[model samples]
Target: MARVETLKRQFFKCLGLLAGCTSFALWASQPQVVEKADKTELEWGNVLFEYYQKDYFEALIEYEYAKTINNDTAKSDYGQMLQGGMLLSYGQAKQSQEIFDRVLARSADPLVRNRAWYYLANLYYHKSEPEKAHQSLAKISGPVPSDLFPEFYHLTSLINSDVENLAQAENILSQVPEDSKHYPYVLFNVAIGQLRSNELKKSLINLTKVNQYAARSEEHASLSDRATHGLAQLALKSGNLPTAWANLQKIRTNGLYSNRGLLTYAWTAIKIKQFNEAIPALEILQSRDIAIPEVQEAKVLLAHLYEQQGAPRKALKSNLISIDEFAKGINRVAEARDIIAKQNVPEEFVRNLDVIIDDSDWFGAQPSIDYQKLTPFLIDLMSSRILNETLKELSDLYAIKKNLENWEFQSNEHLLIMNNADKKSISKEERKAIQRSKAIQQQLSDKKQELKLLMLSLKPEEQKRFQSTIDSIDKEIAILQSRTDGMSRLSQPYKQPASVKKEMKDKHNQVKQKLKQTSRLIAKLEPVVRSLVNEELDKHEERMRYYWAQSRLAKARLYDTTLMELDNVTSNKESGEGVK
Candidate 1:
């Protein structure tokens, strides 16, 4: 059996050499796993069958059985690498890495080593260690499968932000033999790399090559769709309106991109002032997935189209639709509030939405309907009222804190002056000075009370809503009093202990956070309410238009039908009289 195995390897090696040096190198490197196995042959065969059927775990069992055959290094390495690759496919990265590491250490054949390296590089890429992946790729400098060279360059191109490597990636792809099975894939990756590098012209050239190659093959419909869309984007970017529109029209007509492609097409239409042309595309977008940002942009653009068509009111109605959509998006509202911090709510609200919604927002604020008063409709639909209120409350809180700090500093200064007087030695005039110090102490007490009252006024609801918290603070204040002397002096240390200060700060922060949260909720809800009003208004408008169109069409059809009947009756009477 050992002699027969040797003969088989010698024959296979000759065939491999004739196939090419790359194939020979690969075959020489790959471990021949089949062994003079007795019961293990049946078990491993069954495992191979199961692996083909995608039953990885059962196949894994057979793999283990075959590997357990003592003294078969090839079988063991093959089993481990196959299992590792399967595990990697299933997202078990760490286990896959360990298994591949063992395979690399034991495998003597270049082919198996290259395979292991490829898988390891992929694992590293998935783990987000692209640099490590590039390093792993570097180990396969020996004769490799021509088909894998493009993928190698593709991955290397991803190692940096520069376009220089992208050209190298393209050169690698161009090396594929004309008869290579993976020619289309090489071209696709090269084009995608070019696109990333912003070499749009070269990207288009490669994509066109991919399209032509796939067209000749009668396979790869999805690849064709991708290439078509790629060309459309290129055309759009290059201001080749006719060509871009034509390419996008292919995707739209074939219903390939469905909702997504049509949305892109609509923008192209809007770009060329073909406002009405954009309507149908926008309508298709409206009927599809509504959550995508593109759908929202379509709505805004649709409104602009309507405005361009001499319907300003319809335009505002459209913008209002987007505002309502965004209201439901919690993250989007948070984003808007962030903007509100830097800009006024009303002016910035309209314009910020323009920016956030899409670049079409650059068209600036579209004219709204001529409506007197900030109608609950406009308020509910168009305003970020809640954000405004929250901002005001926050400003007031800061102002009150500043006032409190000033009062505390002044009171402390006055007390320190009194203490200095006490420390001084003087005559009867000093006794008079001490009386003056007493008056100053009284004034300081009154001023402290006033400051306390001011703080309470700022948080008027705190005593009622947060009674326990207020009581806790009062208790701490009382404790501080116990530690101080009543000589208009602080019996407690003037400087607060870290623990005490931290406790006070924590309580203050908790209250502040709660207020901010409440204010935000209120702010967020205000737009929702306004949006509800706006939405209701929009719905009413839509229904009215629908009903009016229906009514007019019904009337016109009925009138035509009545006129036909009358003419038929007259013709019948004239015929009867002539016959008589």
Candidate 2:
């Protein structure tokens, strides 16, 4: 259930999956052990079992198998639809689309068709195609499963809100029971739609409802964090410093929005003239990984805050550190970019994706970087949203590639299982002797031929001079050829029967086809992944360069300030000395 929810969070931006997220959890929460489960039920049940356990690799493989059996069956439409939802969570958009579309076309059952339409509509909505979403939604007939009611209404409300049809959206939203698990997600999405329409008053009210709900419950900590942050931003815009500060305080220190919250928290304190509070917050932010843009800004803010507190030396010290740090970061991004540009290394991009698998608060304000491949310097470069989504795309591509590899392996393994195997081996001595002597024999033959050609143009004296060399070469070639001939004779023990050879050839071709399929996918995918990674590296370099320039300018201004102050003190001392 948690794994499904986590995947939903990752993909909800594009899939509009929040509506159906609770349904999976409900599925898991049920009593799943059946004493005499039907064979088909157990089969599809195992797929969901693996998925609920968060073993997505095996689950997807199982689902692929189920699809082969379940295709074109009305009874299997539900399982297919469920797997389509799972695929959507996994960011398998194209595959999910096919599954849903297939369910809609073939399944006469309203439950199955309606479920497909709702998923398709949600996918369209989250992708910002309201017209397409509405078209999909319009295909739905009267009755749906009780569990799908909230999702349908919530999804409809979201579309209406997106179109600025606030009254209709509100009516649809009211249809969803307030106690439903999906209500908060509904409120959050509608509020965002309101925000887009500049309906701040309505948006604020909805965000406040979400914020209040998040505060009271621990279920949706991330949504709570977002709501709290949104409320703070709204408060700040309205000059409600105290309210903004209060909301900022509500965000978890270790939460996804912590970095952004802290930054805003500091400025909110400053606005309310709480210098002591603001200073400590800024200091904490300055100590964080500068890969976050907020952290980068914090360094400058801290320096300026120190200057504001009438501490020029402290400000200058901070600016100097900023200059050095930005310079190092700029250089690191450049070096990493050059390496990526020169070499095609998929492992480098894959390293950035470890955080996605292990710690997937990818949509959070501070994305985690568990493996900083290339260099620690490129962490900031890979932290952008574009790169993050690209990483998801790579994740899907890798999953498909892995599935192909597993299929290829299984096909080869099956040939062995069927007892139709071909064993091709050579003795150690024979193999080594053949491999070693073959190259030397070729070189010796060429050398001997060259010598004969030279002898043809040379006098008898020249021929005599080269004869010993040619003799040495001839001896080497004779020895190598004898070793090669002996190894060949030993290796060519017996020929296979024609029937066995043909069977082995056919199986081998099957294996080869699988290999080709996997190789082709990798050959196509790696360049695209590398290109996106390279672009992020380039952006990181550009950002670091900008920060370095800013730091340098700040450093110069601080130095000038120090020099002017020192000169003033010196002049005052001279006047005092003259008067004395």
Candidate 3:
């Protein structure tokens, strides 16, 4: 029995030494956990194992259980953080925030408090409260263990972006270790933050790092494409055309760039004066069936190139087609308005239908034709028809004026004879004659009043439009009045009132002159204006025909121009080099 006890004691001593060495090794390996632990916490070991195994849900359950047994505030904080992180992994952002808040409020140990604050900041940031998140992160003030430094820097960078404190955010991100799992992510955030702050060169550096570190991540792939495109844009802005082109080419290879990317590339090519190179890309964009705004722009650009290459008709046709396809296609309303104002289907269309307002002879009747019926016909008129129709209407206006003048002259002569008969005696025949003269004068007065009223009623805009006609009628009426006043002074046949003949003649002449001037001016201006209109119509017809022929008969037009030059050149060659 004594020999067995001695052996057992020796075995226990050896076992105690082994346990001491094992505890020392564990402490050396994880000093942060070891120094703070009062006992061997199997719960932390289990929780960490679950986390490493990617069993985040089970790890959270274990951490919650660990929190109940954790006497140290720091350990409890770690457990709560683990729980919150697990909740975040499951997309329970609100629950994660609540746990992080509890850890921050309840944990009193410095390491635990700082960690809780850091994670709580991240929680707030994830919840879009970057200001609150930044405040929480600002509380961390100690040497961060390597494992926690990544989360610290990343969270700091994100919170910096939230508060628009990109520069500080960049500094925090730079402190992260190079070999960290979050290195690439931090670099990307630093670059993006620097970009937001307009630190292009610095941003470029971080972006470069991001490209190197995140090569296998989605962020790496996307960041590469964006950085290349961004560099290209910067190159273009700085006038480095070749570099811009090279960068844009790289961007195009990356599938992440959109049509807008394509457009930028094309425009950059244009800036470098590589018009021909731009043409293919622009044409490809133009040929798309969908009416994307860029497609319209591409068509416009292509059309412009065609124009510069001696293809105005082609350019014009493209513009017309684009307008028809989508009125809002090009996103240039003012440009469209100007184009329509200047070249909208040609001015000749307005002139072609023989739409004339006759101003000559001042009588308003130009066969009393409808102006509305003519608008469409004018728009559709052949170049020759406009000229013919304009002349015909002008003639009709002049003839109508002459008829009106003859009727006025006959009425005046009859009134003069009746007035003379009324002045002779009180005989039945003389009384009847006086009555006839009075009635005739009253009718002439009424007609004059009606013409004066018509003149008075014209709106200013309308009056200005017909001012030439109005002026002419007034001058004619003035001359007629002078002649009538002189006649009345020489012979007053009605003694009842010689004043009546003067007044009646004065009013009649005024009415006649106003009406005549209005009609005549309308007639003259109508034809003159219509002639201008016809000229415009002819021009439009020429343009329309040119565009139609160019689009459908390009070969014919090109051949026609080349044929004469070719013949001259050939004849010269046949004769001699010196032949004229």
Candidate 4:
């Protein structure tokens, strides 16, 4: 019995040893688990995610923590943040380039390298180096980040086009999916290329697609009009005048292509001998403040039509009216110049001339006069010592009023938010909730870390058991984060002080006094400008009358010559009768 018992114990020991060895072998065969990202790396990723979502304020906060980490991922994301101007000014783009270059050269991760290359390409594009941008883009061989794919394809197409590789550009554009936000732009460019290549049918097809897509989006209304204009041009080229006219009529009157379409419509009407139909379109074009290049042609056409209708005097009068209108504009420019020459403007006003011009509502109201045509006048005014000074004072006064209004608006908004928070007693409850949520979040994060560590020691089967628990914890953490997010934002420190309101009030009063003084000075100067303008207008009127009188004199001479010829013909016929 004792020998049997000994055999049983030995058998059990052998079985235990065999099981232990099996376990060791299985562990040895398993691949070594790579360590998951630590807290700082995770935070860096979160910052990048927020930035991707365009939540700039929240991203900025996370960036502050991530920027201190020594990891390559953190550095790469920080560089992107800088490039995006989340925490840095746009002036720091050069610095951002340097950081991206460092990451591209040093990072081991393929995704990081590709991302850095993409950013470098963008910077190069902005710097107007399309060749370098193209080269950087070509370095991206692997799968691109999903969010950047559309921009990637769009930019590649653009660079190809810039390099005059139209075929390549078209090929790249073709790869853009139909559902992509860039699809309309891509299709439009492709259509233009096709049109240039004389592939009219294909171009028309692409243009129709663009029109259909644009019609669904309010933001693309101008694009829709342009596509319609393209269709009109194509129809006209194909000698389908009625089809062309129908397409032209579809363009909205307020659209960007309206002027071109209207001009074409008038020209088409004339081609079809619909004189009356052409007249209204020409009149509208002529009356527009910004002189379209086609206006002169339209005026000549109108004059010819008027003569064809046996209204020579009306044609002459129309020509005179057009000339007078042009002369009046020139006179206004001259008046502005004279005002600058005579005024003794103060330095304060001179310094703020640009701001004054930018903020002035007067220019916006004068839509009849093309602002470009007034460039010389504005330049002279700004360069003039006295006029610039006066203009600057007006600008400063406008700016002061705007600033006061903005301050009051911001103060009211802040007060409303504060009052609501206080009334709801949300401040304290929010603090407590945030603290509790954060505490819970930390506990869950620690558990995740613990699980990750345990997984390294566990067999494959053992590791699977903890995954469900980790996933549950992750969901809980996500919920807690969502609930506390508002509180977290609310707890952020307010940078503006209550005392700013008082300061704004004081500034407002000071600006009011200055505005009154400036207005009075401007009043004193305006009459001088008005007198010069009247003098110039009188000169223009006299010149116009002289031209009109000359035209009438020439007409009278021609008419007298025709009467004399008729009398001579009658005398010839009487002499022939007498000879017979």
Candidate 5:
């Protein structure tokens, strides 16, 4: 009986040992989460992660928070954000330059210094100071971040191009790897350089490569359209009408190349005696925005096509329309020039008027009587009154503009989603989902602030209960964030409704009609406004002249009285001498 009990105990101990080893193996196989050593470092990492994701607003918020902590990395990142125009307008380039200069001058970290130099170079480039840009680029000696390498090379090539150093630009462009996102841009610019140099064969080869890559990737549509347009131009120059037509056909309508492409297409069709094709292309070009420079050319082409089709009256009408458009354009220019000449107000005042006119809500509930003493305030009041009355008279038009803006925003959002879907990347979709979640999280954070305000009104017992609820919300948020961190980058594609698109288009047309009507009203009213402003200024000038004349007369009277006093003194002296 003792031997049987001992055997059972030994077998149980072996089974327990085997179970422990299996648990240890499972633990070893699982992925590990490494915690950052410092709290500030973790926060700084979060800022960098947000920046990498192109969540500039979130990055800026995190950076602002991180700045209170004594961390050099956080300071460097904040400076980088300022220099990159992520947290400010590009108009603040001078301020950005100053921040970069401080980092470059004082940063002990080589990496920080290099980034500062890179951003400084970009600023100089934008400012059109290429020599200074080159100097800034020279300051970057050490290794740069991988993501910035392509930008560095591209900027270098651009600077070379700006200086007309085609050889150097070509050499620099050659260093850009095929897989770089900037590769297509570099290739296009290089082809342009070759074309300018009259290296037709080389240019064609490079352009063809860009076209093929853009088509296969289904990206950079603008670049692809440009490449096709370039090919068309080349074919036309080489007298290859068919090739030119084919190249022009590849270019999508309503693109950067559209007007020129359509015009070229029509001309090429005319060359091939395809009147039917030529007429449609010309008509399409004419139907485009009147603001387009090609509209007049398209009219002439249409007139020619009409004449060829033996429709003399139609051709005459086309010519008449072209002349009418030109006359209207000249009248507009003359009126603008006249206003500028007569209205001698400062440019700043005019710009202020522009702002107030464009945004009715700019003043926010109108200014008080005290504030009306300010020139800007007065101008805003006048402009707001004018715009409000105009809008009231054209209430239907105003409603259309409002609806148009709202529908346009929604349409654009849907279009953006569809465009993102075209990329077909799980990682990208995940990032977008994360961004949406973060936006909601931001709203929740704002709610917490509001809740804190509400706490002031609560009794002690109620406060405690409210605080508990807040704490629970905080915990849920933390859990959501944790889950977000582990989520895979996958999302379903978004498709916008056809009805939404149609509504957007309809609203756009209504807004456009309203704009034209408003423009005509302004055309009549602008002259009156200009005359009033000019009259006011003339009155001011007249008042100044009258004051000057009055001062001159007083001076003359003073001079006459001084002379008389001197003469009287002389006569008195003579009479005293005779009495003696």
Candidate 6:
């Protein structure tokens, strides 16, 4: 009981550390807003308010609007940095990189520069470019803002991890105050770093301490099961069967690790000739609620055990049952895969798919597609890590794509309103505003090229790292070129005031540009999502085919055994010594 208590605490501590790394990554630490006021000041306040409320989309909109109207160029650099981070969170990594570069190139503020450098380093870290990311981090002038410290340290640790600098990673992790909520997790991280470095003895010692220092719950018990399971496997490898058995017993019976545990437990029992325990365990596992490869393998082993115990008939019956089950499973999976291949994954399904992040199985549940169509097929794939991850990525991409579409729709509506506005009473100020819109449109064209050139110049490593960004920009540019080549009105009848007509033209151009950008973004992400879905389906089909082959082989072996048994029975009768 005490051991279980300790296990839960240690595991939960590690889990919380992971949650911190994710949920506290970038904008989660932004300072909350206390007041809202009106133009730049007002928009900025709303940005902060929306951010604090976790309404990141609204916050980004307010920030972009604030940028358009704000007069303070110095402060704009800082605000753009924040906007860049929000874009990164929205999976707009390439756009975020552009913002970071612009801030670094134009801003002289140390604090702003530091924040910008930090984000740039973070972007590099995500790209798996350690040296480049490290170079970016080195450009920071002083301590990062206090609000950014946690995420900053996390990124540093990631860099250190990539470089195999375990000493620095451990040292940084060790700085967590003992009283802080992150303290246990920091200790957990140090142990993990040691484990990753293959300092197994040290890691086990630290893990032991972690378990001793904290209390626990069943909620995060799977992590404990995983650690214990590893220890069992290590013991078995070293010929310490007793130690392996004991360690395997510690795993929870209904946790994420339970399926593999039962399979391991039964195998270990069979190896030790503990038939009483092994048989019942395998029997219990033969139930169809779980269909992991481990469970299927255990069933095969169970039949072999029966054969070894002289129950040839029982073994044959068991193998036949499994062969039948596998046959149905293969056919059902094929039909399901065919159905999936015939239709695109529904956008709404991908958009609504819940993200599951279990360390044991990742997306560990059936996808959000119509289960009725693929019921039994999907059942066998519940614990697929690849499917989980692919589906989750698709969900996020679809969601971002939908957001871009909404923006595109809004721009179209805004353009229509501007195109049809009453022009009889236009003021001089409004005309200047129209001129400013035209100038900004020209600037947008210039900046689009600038952002692309920057994308092309990113650290060259198979071009895979920044390829998505470059492709997106190329697609957007191509879209613009196509539109430019297709149609234009060289002249227009001026029904409204001359200024009003000019304003209308400028507004029309701006709206068209915004619409193009949004449409291009949606276009860029949709194909990536569909390709991932297709890849996931292909991998699943491969697994099903492999399962079918294994079952066929097992069945063939069972048939051979039956023939041998019949020959033995005939030989015994001829000898007149076998009459049981």
> Per-residue alpha-carbon lDDT of model 3 for 365-445, expressed as tens digits?
333333332232233233344354444444434444554566577667856865876666445654454454344444444
Instruction: Work out the TM-score per prediction.
Output: 0.45, 0.64, 0.41, 0.49, 0.47, 0.65
Candidate 4 vs. true structure, TM-score: 0.49
Candidate structures ordered by lDDT, highest first: 2, 6, 5, 4, 3, 1
Model 3 lowest lDDT segment of ten: 344-353
- How do the residues 220-264 of candidate 4 rate in per-residue lDDT, one tens digit apiece? 777878888889888887889898888877877656567777788
Per-candidate Cα lDDT values, in order, are: 0.56, 0.70, 0.57, 0.61, 0.62, 0.62
Give a tens-digit lDDT track for model 1, residues 436-523: 5444434434544543454454445533543453354444334333322232242332453447545655655565665565455545
Error of 5 at 475 (Å): 25
Of 1 and 6, the candidate ranking higher by lDDT: 6
Candidate maximizing lDDT: 2
lDDT of 6 by residue, 288-371 (tens): 442355656766777878878878778778877777766665565555555554444445444434332222332345554543
Instruction: Compare candidates 2 and 4 on lDDT and give the better one.
Output: 2
TM-score for candidate 5: 0.47
Model 1 TM-score, 2 decimals: 0.45
Of the two candidates 2 and 5, the one with more favorable lDDT, higher being better, is 2
For candidate 2, the per-residue lDDT at 563 reads 93
Model 3, position 109, has a per-residue lDDT of: 73
lDDT value, residue 152 of candidate 3: 83
Q: Which stretches in model 6 have alpha-carbon errors above 4 Å?
A: 1-42, 71-78, 102-114, 134-144, 178-192, 209-219, 279-285, 288-291, 339-346, 355-400, 407-420, 423-580
